[model samples]
Target: MSYTPVYFSLREFVDPAIFAARGNNCWQLLSPEILRAADWLRGIFGPITVNNSYNGGRYSESGLRRWESTVGAKYSQHKFGRALDLKFRAPVTPQQVYAHILANQADARAHGITTVEDINSTPTWLHIDCRNWADQDVPVMVKVVQP
Candidate 1:
């Protein structure tokens, strides 16, 4: 089945990367499952702007390194292809967004997400991934290293 590319509002931060990945000015390239999770979040939050999605190959190396140092993983869901970093529109702090994610954490997990982070100890953004696995009721990595 052919999949249609859709833009999730939360993928805005990952620009240049996401756009360059596609020939056209695409926002994100998500699988059906990932799209569904995006849609789910949309329904819960009225409307959200995408922060980043599908980093362009050009930025892959640098982006990967940054994510590894920040998120710490050679193969992040975002790198392997099944995750997104989300944040609210202006006037919305990361903490507020984190609250939203935490509020709906249960429902989000049901859609096959296995990881959700408030983006380091700073709580700058929300990182969510769809691993095609059942909701395990706990984050894959919960070691919060506060700075």
Candidate 2:
């Protein structure tokens, strides 16, 4: 009953180091909730690019980041495989995706997305995470984080 992303591969969800080290086994390290959320967002939007290094693209740390990586915060969700920085294809912008999630909070929550980085902070990509926001008593369905 485990849900795997229909629109993404293991490479897209992991960095080059993890993908090379764990190979297909990398799926075991990822959070199912975050994977489900990714699939849901991909279904609603068009194509989403996470880590494209497998295809000779520049993105690598957009998905899962290793502990040694200094990309974002030291305790970033990326290190725990609970977050993703999605770069949408043309005709689909980050602002549109953010707006969609904000408007459809219940639906987004149903798909396991609890937080999203502010659009202003990430103008090129949409950062979504399955953080445990219920413990914080945040009234919002989807919490918009500044970072």
TM-score of each: 0.53, 0.94
Q: Give per-residue CA lDDT, model 1, range 32-133, as digits (tens).
A: 455566666656555554542343322222121233344445566565546655455567665675566566665655554555654555465566665544
Q: Give the count of colliding residue pairs in each prediction.
A: 15, 0
Compared with the true structure, the alpha-carbon lDDT of candidate 2 equals: 0.90
Error of 1 at 59 (Å): 11
Please, what are the lDDT tens digits per residue for candidate 2 over residues 1-147? 367888889999898998889899999889898999989988988789999988999999988898899999999999999999999988999999999999998888889899999999999999999988646455448988988
Q: What is the C-alpha RMSD of each candidate to the true structure, in Å?
A: 6.5, 1.6
Candidate 2 residue pairs that clash: none
